[model samples]
Structure formats: structure tokens, C-alpha cells
Target: MSSSAAPAAPSAIPSEVFEPPVLAEVVRSGFVEGHHRGSLVVLAADGSVELALGDPAAPVFPRSANKPMQAAAVLRAGLDLAGERLALAAASHSGEAFHLELVHTMLAEHGLTADDLRTPPDLPLDPAEAEAYLAAGRVRERITMNCSGKHAAMLAACALNGWDRAGYLDPAHPLQQLVHQVVEEAAGETVTAVGTDGCGAPLMAISLVGLARAFRGFVLAEPGTAERRVADAMRAHPAYVAGTRRPDTWLMRELPGTLSKMGAEAVQAVALADGRALAFKVDDGATRALGPVLARTLRLLGIDAPVVDRIGHAPLLGGAGEVGEIRATF
Candidate 1:
């Protein structure tokens, strides 16, 4: 076939791709209202498949769940980051006062400014924080965006490596290339696709199985390694990775040795100290269903904690009263 040959016709394509199963159901006043379909994979401590629902092998965008891998890539590029700053570098922060302060400090230390960030300006990710920010008459700013820390860290990596800072987010840039390599190495699979993320960074698509495996690798890696450092920092500073009100923060804070991160559009990945890990994406992109699914999955893993109940508390209301809830089905 010639290099510039026409693409295969639609009729030539096979309909063999798997369809995801219903993972959660919405109930209102004892009536099944709707369903959220998705794919999920749980890997046991020994890296074997423990439980799988739907088509976990299909490639999907992992979104901000890929941050830890990207942070490890930045570390490999010789950008020195540790503790909370390292956590922030891998964060989808809530844009609280502390989160904003650290982002400022990181930029200052790197001889960069908020203007260097490529993330589109937006309000805080946390509802309470966003409300307060709006009440203060503040408009959107790049530094206040959830991915600002990651962008600042990217700029720092470029500065340290003498790479072009202006084009840091470009996939062809040295930093993004390194990130792509690291992601593939960690996931043990080639990226199925490349797209621009909400933060304007290059996004890689991989299967749920690969995503779970990558997170497991981070937790199980040796100390002093870039992967382990990113995992440790995120576990140690859960608030920076998410925020006080987030399930990622709550899970990591309440369950020691656990690393958790959630992405936009109802994507989540979590790893335990013992090497058990899981990743999932709700096909409908319904964020409200994530907590219910996660809590159920944790319970299936034999985890019974108060925090699980807290996370699973997704209630439907009827005129200031709880009517029903979103419950996990699988």
C-alpha cells in the first residue's frame, strides 16, 4: 500500500470491540433512575488480575491520573523536587491558599512566574474554595488553575535542561518526549493515542490494566528511584495531590501507604502499599458516580473503613431530604 493511500472503508472495520458494563446505578425514591457504564481493573499484590468488570483492555485517556508518571519524568530530567513541592508537581491541587502559596514559591525558585504557565485560567477545583475566590471578586488566573504546579515544574525542567520554555508543552519538546518515554516504560505498553489535556500538556491513552500496572510499579519501586519518590511524596502530602475535600486526599490520609489520584471526567487510579492497585473510567463521564464505585471496589478488596462510608455517601435529595443514592452494581 502507498504511504498516502486512502484509509480503510467503514464497512471493512470489525465490530469486535468490547462494550463496558454498568458499574453503578442511580436510584431515586426506590426507583432505578439511570446507570453509569465503565471499565475497571484490579491487580492483586502479585500483579495478577483480581477482578475485572467491562472491557478494561480498551485504551482510554487517564487524564490527571497520569501526573505521578509525568512528575517522575521531570525528576529524571534533573529538576530537584522533594516533599510537598514534589507532591505539588504531581498534583491536581484544589487551589487553596496553601496550594497557591507553594505554586508561587516553586515558580520563584525556578526563576519563572505565573505567566510561564500554559494551563488555561480557571477557578479552584474545590467548591468551597471556588466560592470564596469568587466572593473575593477574583477572576480566573493561570496560577489558580489546578494544574499550575505541574506547569511550573515543567518550566523548571526545561530551565534546568536548557530546553525551550515557551514550547515546553509541545509534544515534540524534550520534556514531553521524556514524559512519553517514561509513561510507556512504566505502563509496559505503548501509548495508543496522543491528545492535549485540559492543562495543555500532552496526554497519553492506555488501558485500565496498564494504568493500574503503572501505579503498582510506582508503589513497589525501590526507594531513591524517581517513581518511588513521586509515590512517596504524594502519599506523604495527600492534600497537595488533591485537597482537603477530595477522595484522593481522604483515601491517602486515612489509609496509610496508599497513593490515590483522580482525574477529570470520572477517571481514578489508586495503589496500596502492598502492591494492590486499581484503575477505572466511567464511560458517561459522571463524576458523582466515582465515589460510589471506588468505595465499592475498596470493599471488594476487603477494606472496611469509616472513610469508605464517607466516600460512598452520594445521596439524592428531594426538597432538602435524602431520597436515595447512587450505588455500585459491580
Candidate 2:
């Protein structure tokens, strides 16, 4: 169920290739001079698309939004992670202290080290955590990077299966083959392109529709299976999934049974308990556009809570008070 070769060159295909429609507008001081182009898709429980915007079929690397699927792959590969550890496997954490501590525990429990991490050394993605680290006269480490959780789990998977922990990040590794198979099966589509991710793991290119389909597939998975285990762990430990004050964490908290994960390049995917799902990407890669777009899309899908409004849209700052906002054009 796996393909050895990369599908095609997603690197050559610019995100602007098909030129997705403007789904959001940036208004500053009452002027509408900028906008974001991207695609959005919502799939109903029966797998029929309830809504579609822009070129939904074009290839887009889902970034960390694909983590849950990747986690499922590790589950199938025989890692017995659950709760916070399992959630962390699918996390794009904000690099909080607890987050780093958990990462350390996982590696220590498995007899691995931060040296085992393949992701680059970097500062915390969480601003306060980064400032605090520097104030303590500490240097940036790979463990502080947001993707350390995912990397630790990859190492743990290697530890679990007695595979080559050294070359686990390689696309040719047996673990990654299982990852590709799980990703394609979850998306119900063949990956059309492949690229190395920011964290150095293989990233498969799937359409926005395919992305939504995958998230939907995850939450709707049957009880007591590997797929459901990933979702359950994430849902039960939202804090580990993205850390304090993050959208995915807050969304999961406020909505309960609803899963939200945002990726780099302004990609967002949310799935409901009933199996409805939405996936989108902003062509300009403005992460600020993510909140408003997802808020409006969820509202369109019948989630009308005020919390979504508060967290989903980005606010415009002024000297005294808010003056403008980034609003969904559609």
C-alpha cells in the first residue's frame, strides 16, 4: 500500500499555480487593499463535499496538519503511546516548559537523547518561553523546537520496533513507508507529490479536499482502533497537542469533540464529532488570515458559538482601540 517514489515535483508547482480565489480580505483603517487566495473544502459524514472553494484538487503540502495521520502510522508500527504522549506525537506544540519536559521524558524512557532528534535546533515558537530561556543564559536546543514532540515520537517508534534509530528520518526507512501508507489510506487518495518537511520528515502533497477527507476519516474512525486512539489521545490532552493559548488547544477545549490543527503556510483543518470536516490553505501564507477564515467557515458549517469568533479572527490593533480587522470575504 506504499509507493517508493515521490509522486511529482510539488516544489516546482508554486502555491499560486492555479490561483485560488480570494477567501479573505485584510482591511486596515477601512481600506481593502490586500487579500489572501486559497482553497477550502468541507466534507460531510458520507464523504460528499458540502462546500468547495478555489482549486480544491491542487496539490498542497499539509505541513504539520498531517501529524495525526503520521501518528496513526506510528501506532500501526507498534508504538504503544497514549494520552499526552500520544497527543504529543501529533502535536505542533508551542515549546512550553511542560512540553519540553515531556519530550525529555519520552526520550529518556526510550533510552534516547536530544541527539536523536532530526529536526534542527531552534528557539521556542512560544514567545514567552523563548524569552525566558534566553534570560536564563541558556542556548537554543533542538528540544526547544516546536516539532520536538513529533520527532521524539518518531524516535520512539524506532525504539519500539528496534529499527535503525539513526536513519529513521530517511524516507527510505521502514517506518516512513508505513507513514506513507497510513497517510494515503487516511486521505483516501494517492499522494501526488512528496517533499522533505521543515522538520526533515517526508511530507506528502495532497489536495485540500483530500486533507479534509483525512481529518474526517480520523475522528469518524471506529472505537478501539489505532486511528481512534490517535484522535482520543489528542482530544483528551489538547494542551499537549499545541500547548497553552494555542488555537488548536483552545478550540478543542471550547468545542469538545472538535479537533483543530493548524499547519505552516496558513493551512488549517478542523473535524467535528459527527464527521464533518473543513480544510483550507491561504496562498499568501499569511497565518493571520487563518483565524478569520476558519471562524467564518465553521460558522457557515453551523458552529455558531461566540468563542469561535474570539479565537478564529485576527484583530487589528490601533493606538487606543481596535480600528479594523481581517474578515472573510466569502
Candidate number of the best lDDT: 1
lDDT of each structure?
0.95, 0.89
Taking the tens digit of each residue's C-alpha lDDT, what string does model 2 give over 31-146? 98689889999888788998999988888999999999989988898888999999999999988988999999999999999998988888888788788888999987899888
* Candidate 1 global CA lDDT score: 0.95
At residue 325, what lDDT does model 1 achieve? 98
lDDT of 1 by residue, 94-192 (tens): 999999999999999979999988899999989999999999999999999999999989999998989999999999999999999999999999999
Model 2: lowest-lDDT 10 consecutive positions:
9-18
Q: List the residue pairs that clash in candidate 2.
A: 291-312
Off by over 4 Å in 2: 1-18
Q: How accurate is candidate 2 locally (lDDT)?
A: 0.89
